[model samples]
Target: MLTGQQYKDSLKDGRKVYFQGELIEDLETVPALAAPLNEVASGYDKYFNADPDAINPVTMAPMSAADLRDRIPVITEMDLLTNTTYQSLMTLSVAAARLEAHVPEVVPRIRAYVEQARKDDIRITECITDAKGNRSLAPSKQEDPDSYVRVVERRPDGVVIRGAKLHISAAAFGHDLMVMPTKAMKPGEEDYSIAACIPANSPGVHMTNTTYHPTGRDPRDFPVSSHRSIPDSMVIFDDVFVPAERIFLDGQTAHAAVFAHSLGLWERLGGVSFMVEQADELVGLASLIAEANGTAKISHVREKIDEMMIHATLLRAGLEAALAHANSTPEGYFYPDDMYTNVTKYQGASQFNTMVKHLHDIAGGAVVTAPSMLDFDNPELRPYLEKYMSTGSTVSGEYRTKLFHAIRDTTADSFGGWHFVTNLQSGGGLFAQRLVTRKNYDLERARALALKAAGLSGA
Candidate 1:
C-alpha cells in the first residue's frame, strides 16, 4: 500500500482535471481540492501504515453478518474516496455473483480486478449517471449517439467508449473510474450496456470538477465543510480505450442491470449508515442550539427536539435491521438486507428537509446572520457584540456564535445545499429506493395476515 506522500505523488500523472474553467496541472497545489486530497492521502497512511498485516476495513469483504455490522463505524468515518472504493469493489463482487450463472466469462475478470485493486490499494470512483440527451428516449433511440456511454469501436485488444458521466463524485482524484449502465437496458441497447474500469488519467478522459468547499472564508466559519469537501466532476470520455481485461460487461444487455442493482444495494446501505449518524448530529445541533438559546424548556421547541430524536432513533433502528438481516451471495460475500436498507434510506432522505427545517426554525435567524468570528477578533467591537450576544455567563457570546457558525456551515450554506440535494439524490434517489423497497417487501406475508384476520382462508 502507498503512503500518504506516495498517494499525493501518484496524482501527478497526466489526468486532465479542470476547476473553474482552468485546467488544474497539480491537484495538490489547488487549495480547493487540497483538503480532500490530503484527507484521502492521510486515510491511506492511517489505514495501511498503522498495521501492515491487519486488513483495512475499507477494503475488507464482509464474509458474514457480524462482519457487515463491524464495518459500520469504519464506513461512517471513511473519506468519500475510500468509501466509494469500497462501494466499487462490493458492486463488482455482487454483480459478478449475479452474473456467474449466466455470463460466467465476466466473473473471473471481475474477481481478478477486485483482487488487483485491493492489492494495489487504489482509490476508485463510480461513474454511472450519464449525460443523457433525452429523459424519455432510450439510449439507442437518443438523437445523439453519445447520449450515454457506449462502445464506439470493438477492437481485438479492447473497446473504445465515448460519452460523459455527470455528478461523479471525486472522479478527478481517484485512480480508476468504474463505469456502468445507469439503468437497465433492452436488446437493441447493447452498445450502451458496456461496463468497464478506466484509469483516471486514461487518454481522452477529462474531468471538469466542482466542490462545496468554502473559498476565501475563515475556516472556523465553515466548521463542517472547511476541512472536508469532495469534488464532483463532469467526467467526459472522448473515445477512451479500455483493455479487454478491464471490461467487466460488454454488450451483455440482459445482465446490464445487475451492476446497477448491486451498486444500489451497497450504496443504499452506506447511505443509510451515514444518515443514521447525520440524523443524530442534526438532533444534537437542534438540542444544543435550543439550549444555547434558552428555549429548551419551551413546549414547541421540546416537541420539535422530540421529533428529531425519534427521527434519529428510527434511522438507527433501520440500520440495525439492515445489518441483522444481511444477505449473502453464493460466494459467501455478505451485503446488507435490501429491504431494510432501501426503506431506511428512503425514510431518511424523504424527511431530511423537514429535519433541517426544524433545525433552522429552532436555530432562528442567527444561523445565517450571525456575526463573523473575525468580528469577535476586533477588540473594540468584541465588548459590544459580546454584551449583546451573550445570554448569560454560561453561554458566552463566542460560544453561542460558534454554535451558530456550526449550524450555518452545516445546514444553511453551500455545504448544507450539497447535503440537501445529495441526501435525496445519492444512492439513486427516493424513487429508486422506493422501487427497491417495494420489490423487496414481503407483501405476500401481509396478504396472508390480512386474510387470516378477515377469516377468508383460501377465498
Candidate 2:
C-alpha cells in the first residue's frame, strides 16, 4: 500500500549502524545498493498506487455520491485475475517488508514508523536474522556488544536502539523496515524481542555493502549470478529512535515469535509462489541448455529434466492446495496451509540445488572452466577459444559457453552465492520448515481414520 516516495521520505531520521568501520549517510542514493532498492520501490508502485485494477479488482457499477469514496477499485479485467494478483502481492509485500527492515541504513525508527505504514500502506520487510556471528553461540550469547541490535535509549517520544541487524535485504532502500527478534526471544532476552517498522534514512543508522556474487558484472559476457540475485546484508542499529506508535510489542518475548508468525502466512505463501514461478524458469533454462548442447536426446538428461519438471509441478500444486484450504484468523487475514507451504519450500530448496548440479553434469566442465565471453572476443584468443569450444550446431561454441557460464555462476558458487543463501534464510531455515511441518501433523485425524478402519470406532 505504501508508495516508493512515501517509503523514501519516512527514513529522514538516522539510525545507528556500522559497515566497513564507517556510517552510510544516504542508503537510497547509494550506487552499489541503489538498483535493488529502486527495484523494490518500483514493485510497490505497481500495487494500489498505480495499478489497482491490475492488482485489486472491484465492481464499478454506477452509484450515488455515497458509493464513490467506498469503491476500492473497478474490475476492468476479470475479477478472479485481479483478486489473484492482489493476493499474490499481498504475500509478496509481506515478504518484502520483512526483507527491508533488517538493514540499519533503511529505516529511521524501526517500530513507530511501520505502525504508521499499516495505517498508510504495505511497508514490511523481514528483520529476520541477526548476524548470528558464530552460528555456534546463540543471540544472547554473542561476544560483541553490537552482535545483536538492542535498545540503548527509551525517550518519551520513542525508544532508542543500539547494536546491529544482519543479513537483511532491501533495507537499504525501503520505506519501512520490520524489526523483530531473529529467533524466539526468551524472557531474559526481552530487549531483543521487538516487532516494529522504521523509516529508511534514520539517524545513527549504517549498512555495509555485502555481496556473495558478481553483483555488477557487465552484459557483453554478463555473469549469470548477476542476473538472478537474492541480495542480503548485515545491518547495524546503534541507539536509534523508535516512537511509541510504531511499537507493536517490545520485550514481549512470549509474543515475539507470535507477532512474527501472525504476519507470516501471507509471506510463506508468497515464498512458495515465487519459488514455483522461478522453478518453472529453472526447468526451462535447464532444457534450453541441454538442447543447445545436443544432450537433449540423451536419456539421462531427459530423466534429469523430467525430475526438475516434476519438482516444479509439485510446487505449483502445493500452492494451490494451500490456497484452496486457507483458513481465516482473528487478524482479518487468511492463512494458507503451513504444511503444504513447508513441503513445497523444503523440496524446492533441495530440488533447486539438485537442478543446478544436474545442469552442470549436462553442461560438462565448460560450465565452470569455460573461457569468459570477453575472452572469445579478444583478437588473440577469440579464434582459439571459439575454435575449440563447440559443443553442438545451432549457436556457436562461444554462445554455448556463454550459456553454460551463466549456469556456473549460479550453480557454481553457492547458487549465486548470497542469493541462494538468502533464499534458504528467507522464510526461516529448511530445518525450521521441517519443525513447522511436524507441528502441523494431523495425528489425531490419522488415529481416528486408523481406528475406523480397524472397526474400533464408528465410521
Candidate 2, poorest ten consecutive residues by summed lDDT: 72-81
- The residue-by-residue lDDT of candidate 2 on 173-209, one tens digit each, is 4445567666676767777776665664566666664
Show pairs that collide, candidate 1.
Answer: none
In terms of TM-score, how similar is model 1 to the real structure?
0.96
| Alpha-carbon RMSD, each predicted model | 1.7, 8.1
TM-scores for every candidate against the unseen true structure: 0.96, 0.74
lDDT by residue for model 1 over 325-385, one digit each (tens)? Answer: 8988887888888888888988999899999999999989999998998999999999998
Off by over 4 Å in 2: 1-31, 41-124, 131-148, 183-189, 213-216, 223-230, 379-385, 445-459
Model 1: CA > 4 A from native: 50-57, 447-459
Model 1 / residue 101 / CA error / Å = 2.9
